[model samples]
Target: MILFKAALATGVLTVGLSASQAAYAAPLSASIQSAATDPRANVKIDSKIQVERTEESASGEITTTLLDPATIKVIPGDKLLFTNAYRNTGGSAVTGFVVNNPVHPAVALTEVLEDWALVSVDGGKSFGKLSDLSVSETASESAPTSRPAQASDVTHIRWVLASPIAPGASGELQFRGIVR
Candidate 1:
C-alpha cells in the first residue's frame, strides 16, 4: 500500500488526484430558475465607470482648464504635455487593458518618458507593444495629425497597469505631443 501510494503520487495516476479534487471541490449546484420577474442572467452592473468633467469656477462659471492644467494652445512644432490619470474602483483587478486616445487633427503624439513607463503610438490601442520612445530624441513623426480631430476624437492617453491596481489605487501617464 505504501509503494502504491508513492507511485500514485508520482506517476500517471496523479490525474486521478486532480479529478477527485475537482469532484470534491465542485461548487454546490443550485437550480437556475427563469422567473418572469428575474432580470437577464447576462446583465451586469459595471463595477467601474469613468467620470470626467471640466473644472468649474467658484461662481459656477465654466473654466477652460484641462485636467487641472491651463488650456492647451500650442504653436506648430510645439510640444504639449498630456497628463493621463486612471483610478481603479472595481472589486477585481483590471488586467490586460488597452487605451486609445487619438491625436487631434491639429496635433501629433511625440516624446513619451522612456524610463518612466511603457508607451504605444497606436493611439493607446496597444501598450508597450512598440519601441520605447528615446528620451534624447525628438518626438515621433507619427505624432503629427494626418487630419483634424473631430468631435469623436480621442484626446486622452491610456495607461496599462503592469501590476494589480488595488481598490482605490490610481495611476498616471504623462507624455508630450506637438501641434501640427
Candidate 2:
C-alpha cells in the first residue's frame, strides 16, 4: 500500500507541475509562407506627362503683358472667369496634354451647379466628373447639350499644352463667362 501511494503521489505531483507550467507556458507561433512579403513590390510601372506654359502679345505687338491669376466675386447667379496660360519650353514638339480644374474650395462649387445655372459652375469636380467630360468639344454645350463646360458660360478656363512648346515657346488660354 505504501509503495502504491508513493508512486501515485509522485505521478500526481508530476501532473500538477506540468499543469502549472503549461498554464504559464509560452504560446506557439506560426508563420505563413505566402503572406505579404513586400509592401510595394508588386507595384506597376510609372508613367509621366511633361507639361509647360507661356504667353505672348497677339499680332504686330511688341508689348509684354503682365499676366496673373484673377480674383472674382459674385452672387449665386453671377459669372466668374478663370484663365490659364502656358508656354513651350521644350525643344521637341508635344501634343495631347490635358488640363483640369476643380471648384475652388473657398467658393462653394456645389451652389454654382445648382438648378437654373444661377450659380457660376465650372471645372471637373464642380458639375461633373473628369472622366465623363473628356474631349475639348465635350466641354462645350454644343456637343451633347448636357450643360457643356465650353458653352455653359465657361465660368472657368484651363489651358493644356497640346502642341510641342518649341524651345522658348509660349501660349495662353483665356476664358470669359456670364452669370445667370
Candidate 3:
C-alpha cells in the first residue's frame, strides 16, 4: 500500500469547488488553497482530493488506499473522493452555509453520504435528493415525460449545513464519484 501511494504521487489534479450561490470559477490543486472569503458569510473554503483504492488480502479481508490525484494517472472506473472543506473565518457565526461541487463531465456521481446532500441533473440548475427529483423520459412516441432522477444523471452535488457555523468553526462536505 505504501509503495502504491508513492508511485501514484507524481501527477496533476484539479478539483472543482464552490460555496453558496457564489461560484468559484477556478479549480484547486493538491495543496490547500489560501483562505478564501465567502461573500455571503465570510467563511473560507478548501478542498481535499483523494482516490479510493480497495485491496483484498489472501485472508479475505479488504483494505483501501488513497491515491494523490495530482501525482498519478486517473483512468476510467477509478473512484475518486472530492471534499469541499469550509471554515468560518469571520468574527461571527454564519447560518445556512451551503457547499456545492459540480460533478465533472468525465465522472459519474456514486454516493453522497452526507445527510444534507442533494444532487442536480439539469447541469446544476436545480438540486434535490435522488428520491425526490425526477427526469423527463419518453413513455410514448408522441411526447416525453418525467421520471424519478437517478444518481447517474447527477450534474452537481450540494449540502445545506444543518446548523450555524460558529465563529472560527469548520466542517467538510463530500461526495463520491467513479471515473467514466
Candidate 4:
C-alpha cells in the first residue's frame, strides 16, 4: 500500500490513501510517514491490523491479536486501527497544524477515537463532526436529496490542533475501521 502526502493550497499537508492499496494488502500493516521537508512537524503514523478471535481455552475468552502481513491474512470483518503520533520538532510552538487522511475505499470507518478530529464525506472540501455532515443521494429520486452521513460515507478524516503543539510535545490520533 502506498501512503501519499500532498501539500495543498491552504498549506495543510494531506496524507492520501491509495484506493487500490487494499487490493495489494495481504495482512494490512501500516507505516509511519515522515514529512522530512516540512521542517516544523514530525508526525509518525502507524496503522495496526488486528482481528478478534475466540481461542479454544478453558475460559473461552475472546481476544484481539495483531496480525502480521507476512503471515496472517486480512479478511472481511477484521478491525483496523489507524494511529497518528506527532511531535513538534521545530524550535518554537507550532499552531495551525492539520493532518488529513483519506480513507481507503475498501475500509469502512467505524469510530473516531479523537474528539478533536473532523470528517469529510464529500471529498475534503468541508469538514465537521459526523452528526453535522451530510451527502447527496442522486440515484434515488428525480433530484438530489440530502442524507445523514454514515461512517461508511466518510471519505476523509482530519485532525486539527485546537492549541499550539509545543516543541518535543507528542500526542496521538486514531480511528477504528472494518474491512469491507
Which candidate should be chosen as best, given TM-score against the real structure? 3
lDDT digits (tens) for residues 1-180 of candidate 1: 000000001121112224333222112121222323321211121211111234578899975432211222223544445444556555555444333333444445555453434443444444442333212222576553344332123333434435655556666555555545
Model 1 lDDT, full chain set:
0.35
Query: How far does residue 28 in candidate 4 sit from its true spot (Å)?
Result: 14
State the lDDT of candidate 3 residue by residue for 1-180, as single tens digits: 000000111123223322321122124332222334432346666666577889999999999998666545556778878777778777777766566666767678888879667778997788787899989888899998998888878888777777878888887777788877
Model 1: lDDT of residue 139: 50
Per-model lDDT: 0.35, 0.29, 0.64, 0.62
RMSD of each: 22.3, 29.8, 10.0, 7.9
Between candidates 2 and 3, name the one with more favorable TM-score: 3
Q: Which pairs clash in model 2?
A: 53-86, 53-87, 54-86, 54-87, 54-171, 88-165, 94-164, 139-149, 139-150
| Candidate 1, residue 73: lDDT | 22
Residue lDDT tens for model 4, 1-180: 223232112211112323343323322223433445453434433333333433566788666665443244556666766666666666667666766777767678899898778999988889899999888889757778888999999888887777877877888777777767
**Which pairs of residues clash in candidate 4, taking residues 3 or more apart in a chain or in different chains?**
none
Q: Model 3 reaches what TM-score against the true structure?
A: 0.73
Error of 2 at 14 (Å): 82
Off by over 4 Å in 3: 1-41, 58-60, 138-141
- Tens-place lDDT per residue, model 2, 75-127, is 23333333333443444443443333322332222222212222223433343
Question: What's each prediction's TM-score?
Answer: 0.38, 0.29, 0.73, 0.71
Can you list the residue pairs that collide in candidate 1? 105-147, 105-148, 105-149, 108-143, 109-143
